[model samples]
Target: MADDIHTTREPDGTTHTTTVVDRDPKRGGGAGITLLVVAALAIAAFLGFQFLGNEKAETGAVTEAAQKVGDAAQDVGDAAQEAVK
Candidate 1:
């Protein structure tokens, strides 16, 4: 918010003047940026804890799923062999 002025005198003795003004407002983004960063960090921390907390349970569940799949495959193979006989 500043004003710049210019003045000139013509050969006819009449004075001409011009004023240029800047009216843009200036503000700080630190508060918004700080809030965003804090929110992101909080989300990351929450997800990290959830992942770590369920790690062992997830591994055991995966192992059980694999074994069940293996058993199902073996049963299908046996049925196919019997049909081929």
Candidate 2:
């Protein structure tokens, strides 16, 4: 904080004084911003990991469906060969 005083003399030989008060500038604001950024990155990483896990589960399901279809196809081919015989 800062204070300033001004004194002035008028034409009527009267003196007037005034005081001004100023606020101090803030310091070390960067630490709060850094903390916010770190928090945001942490949340993003957590969400990304969760999404990756879900993707792996979906991929496994798709692979299992494909395998079942392939097995069915093989069984149909074996039945056709038996019929021809």
Candidate 3:
């Protein structure tokens, strides 16, 4: 048995019909493109974050090494002054 079908009339006095099988193909394509763009942006953001994190780590290591070198030089200078006394 067929289900009850509904009908509607347009404002211009024309009969317009709609069915479940009638869908807009462009909508499907648009959704696919939107998903693809979002995925691409996500990947790009991840890579950018990784690059920035690595750069910060490298900078921190360099700064720590420089500070240690400066401390050693000060110690050596103190030792030299004590020897001359």
Clashing pairs in 2: none
Write candidate 2's Cα lDDT for 45-83 as tens digits.
Answer: 999999999999999999999999999999999999999
What TM-score would each prediction reach against the true structure? Answer: 0.42, 0.65, 0.66
CA lDDT of every candidate: 0.95, 0.97, 0.87
lDDT of 3 by residue, 8-83 (tens): 8989998866554544456558888999999999999999999999999999999999999999999999999999
Candidate 3 local lDDT, residue 33? 95
- Expressed as tens digits, the lDDT of each residue in 1-85 for candidate 1 is 7999999999999998999998887677889999999999999999999998799789999999999999999999999999999
User: Among these predicted structures, which one has the highest TM-score?
Assistant: 3
Q: Look at candidate 1 and tell me the lDDT of residue 50.
A: 93
**Better-scoring candidate (lDDT), 1 or 3:** 1
List clash counts for every candidate, in order.
Answer: 0, 0, 0
* Backbone clash total, candidate 1: 0
lDDT of 2: 0.97
Deviation (Å) of 52 in candidate 3: 0.7
Q: Each candidate: RMSD to true structure?
A: 9.7, 4.2, 8.0
